[model samples]
Target: MNELGSRRLFFKYAVPQMVGLLFNSIYLIMDGVFIGNRLGRIGMAAAAISVPVIEILIAISMALASGAGIMISDRLGRERLGEALRIFKASILLSALVGSAVALLGNHFCHGIAGFLGATPGIHDQAVGYLRYIVLFSPFLLFSFLLGGLARNDGRPGLAMTALTLGSLSNVVLDYLFLFPMDMGIEGAALATAIGPVVSVIVLLPHFLLKRGRLYLEKATIRWKDWLDILRLGSPSFVMEFSIGIITFIYNVAIVKNGYGEIGLAAYLVIGYMMLIFLTLFLGMAEGLQPVFSYLQSVGNHGKNDELLSFARCFFLAIGISCYMGIVLFGRDFISIFSPEEIAMIDLAEKASPVYFAGFFLAGFNILAISFRQSTGRTRSAMAISLLRSVAIPPVLIGLLPLILGRESIWACHSLAEAGTACYIFKTTRRNERWEERWENRLPRYTVEDERTTRSGPSTSRST
Candidate 1:
C-alpha cells in the first residue's frame, strides 16, 4: 500500500466529488421541477430548449477545469510543485476571461442561437427572459467551476462539495421564493438559479484569497503561451460536451422535421437531463479514480493502474445495467415530472433513454482510458480516443443516422457511438499496456551507497 491508497483517501476524495456532482444534479432536477410545475408547458419546453446553449458554456468551463486539473494533478504527483501552481492560477484566469466572453456573446445573440435551435416565434420571449438573467450570472458560474477544480485538486473535495451543495440548495429554495411567491414568472426561476452560482463563488473566493489551502489564488504574469496546453489538453473534454451541443441542435431539427416539433423537443430535453443525472454516476466513478490514477502513474504503479482501468469498466457496466432496468421498469415515473399531459411523451422518453444510454457502460471505458493515458503522460492517446469518440463519430452519427432511421435515430446515435469507440479503445489499450510496462520497469533503482550501510565500520554490508 502506498501513501495514497488508504481507505481514508477514497472516502475523503471520492465521496466529496460525488456529493458535489450529486448536489449539482439534484438542483438541476429541481430547476426542471420548479419550472415545469409553476410556469406551464411552454415554460418547460423553453427551459428544455435552452439546455444546449448552456451546455456549450459548461462545456468550455469543464474543458478547462477538468483538463487543466488532470494535468495539474499529474504535475503535483510528479513533485513539480511550482509548475502545478502556475497551471492552477493560469487556469483560473483563462476560465474567467473565456467565461465572461461566452456570457456576453451568448446574451447579445441569444435570440439568434435560440431560433436556430428551434425556439418558436410564439415562445421567443420566454426564452429571452430566462437566458438574459442566466447570462448575467456568468462570472459566478465560471469562477465556481475554476475554484471547484482547484478544491478537488487540492485534496479538499469537501470544500468543493460544500460550495456546489450550497449553490444548489440556494437555487432550490430561491426557486420557490422568487418564481412561485413573487410572481416573477419564468424569468424568476432563471434568476434564482443564476443567483445560486453567484453565492457559491462568494463562498469559494475566501479560500483563494486567504490562501487557506493547497489551492489558493496567486498573482502572476499571465503566460499567454501556457494557454496552449490548457486548450489542447482541455479540447478533448470540451469537444466531448460541445459536440453534444451540436447533437442537441441537430436532434431538435430532426424532431421538427418529423412533425412532432415542440412535443419532440420537450421529450428530448427531459431525456437529456435524465441522461446527465445518470452520467454523473459515471463521472463520480471517473472522478474517484482521477487522483488515484494521477498518483499511481506518478509512482509508476502498473498493476494498480491496470486494476483501476478494469475497475472503471466494471463499475460503468454495472451502472448501465441499473439505468436500463430503471427505464424499463419505472419509465413513466421518470417522465412523471414533465406533466400528466406527458403520458405519450413519457412512453417515448422511456424507449429513448436506454437506447441512448446503451453504451453508457462503454462510456466508462472511454473515460477510464482517457484518464489513464492523461495521468501517465500519454496525452496523444487520450486525444486520439477523444477525437474518435467526440469529434469524428458524433457528427457523423448526426448526419447519417437520421437519414437512415428517421427521428428516433437521433437519440440512439450517441450510445451507438459510445459502444463503437469503446471497441477501438479496448484494442488500443491492449497496445498501451506494453508501453506502460516498459515505463514501469524504468523507475529509479537504488545505488550501492544505502541506508543499510552501518556507520561504525567499513565492514558493514549493505543490502540492495
Candidate 2:
C-alpha cells in the first residue's frame, strides 16, 4: 500500500469492492423479482414492509465492521499488528453477541414488529414470515459483513470480494430453487436471504483461520472500552446505513397515509430497488477505499490523501449523473421486470422515478463525503453529514413537502435531502480548505522567524 500509487491503489481496492457490492445488490433485486412474479403485488408489498428490519440488521453489522476496520487499518499502518488482531477478535465477538440478541428478540416479536413496520392485514402474515427467517439467521448475516470488512482492512480485498460474490451467487440460485421448485412462499425468500450470508462467512473464515492476513481468529480478552470505541468511531456508518431503513419506513407510512395503499408500496418497492443498486455502488467505492484513506492518514501522507479524494470526487460525480440518467430513461423497463403483469404499478413507478431520483446525481457525492470524513478520523464531521442527510432532513421533507407542495411532491423528499446535504458539504469543505491554505501559507514565515530567533538568541527576538 505504501509503495502503490494513488490511481493503482484506488482501482485495486475500489473495483473489487464495487463488483462485489454490485453482485450483492443484484441478488437483492432478484429476490424482489421472484417475489413480484411468484406472489404478485401482495408479495412485493410484504417484502417491502420487511425492508426496514433487514436494513437495520445490515446497518448494525456495517457499523461494527467499519469501526473495527478503520482502527485495524490504522494499527497495521503503524506496525502494531498485535493491537489490530485484538480489535479484530473483539469485533467478531461483538457481532455474534449482537446478532444472537437481535435474532432472539426479533423472532419473539416478529408479528408485532411487522405491524409496526406498517404491514397491513393483507400482508401481515407474509411480512411476519419473511422477517422471522431473516432475524433467525442474523448471526450469519452479521458475520458475513464483519469478516468481509476485516478482510479488506487486513490487506486482502480480493478475498473479501470473492467471498461476497460467491455468497450473492448462492443467493440467486437458492432464491429460484426455493421459490419455484420447492413450493415455498415468502419464507423461502427469507431463508435464501439468510443462508447467503452463511456462505459468505464460511468463505471468509478460512482466510482468517489460516492466518493469510494480519488478522486471524484467536482468543482475546474483550474490554468495555474497546466496544465503546468501536461503536463510537462507527456511529457515522451506522447512521448512514440505518438511514436507509428509516427512509423506507417513513416513505411507507407516508404512502399509506396518502391513500396509495398496497399498489403504491409495490411501486415504491421497485423504485427502492433502483435506489439500492445505486447506493450499493457508491457505498462500495467508499468502503473499498476506506482502508487506503485510513492508512494514508496514519502515515501522514496528506498529498496522497488529496489526490485520492480528487479521484473519488470525480468518480462519484460521474456515477451520480449516470445513475439518474439511466433510471430516468429506462426506469419503466426496470419496473416491468418486477411485475410485468401489473401495468398500474409499473406506470406509477415510471412517473415517480423522474421526480424521486432527480437529486441522486449528488447522492453519491454526499456518501463519498461522509465516508471520506470517517476514514480520515473526522468522526464528528462524518456523523453530522450522515445525520443531516438521512435523519434530520428527509423526515422533515417527507412530512412537510406534501402539505406544502401537494401530495405528489412527496416523492421528491429524498432528492431534496440529497441536494441539501451536498450544499452543506460544499460550503463546509470549502471553508476548511481555505483555513488549511492560510495555515500552510503562514508555515514558512513562522519557520523563518523561529530560525532567526534561534540564531540571534532572546535579545534579538525582543529587539524585533
The candidate scoring highest on TM-score is 2
Give the alpha carbon lDDT tens digit for every residue of 331-380 in model 2. 88888876688899999999998999888878889988888899889999
Candidate 1: worst 10 consecutive residues by lDDT? Answer: 451-460
The lDDT values for all models are: 0.73, 0.88
Q: Count the backbone clashes (under 3 Å) in each candidate.
A: 0, 0
lDDT string, candidate 1, 423-450, tens digits:
8987886777789889978875544655
Q: TM-score, each model?
A: 0.85, 0.92
User: What residue pairs are clashing in model 2?
Assistant: none
Best by lDDT: 2
Could you tell me the C-alpha RMSD of candidate 1 in Å? 4.5
* Model 2 residue 408 CA deviation in Å: 3.2
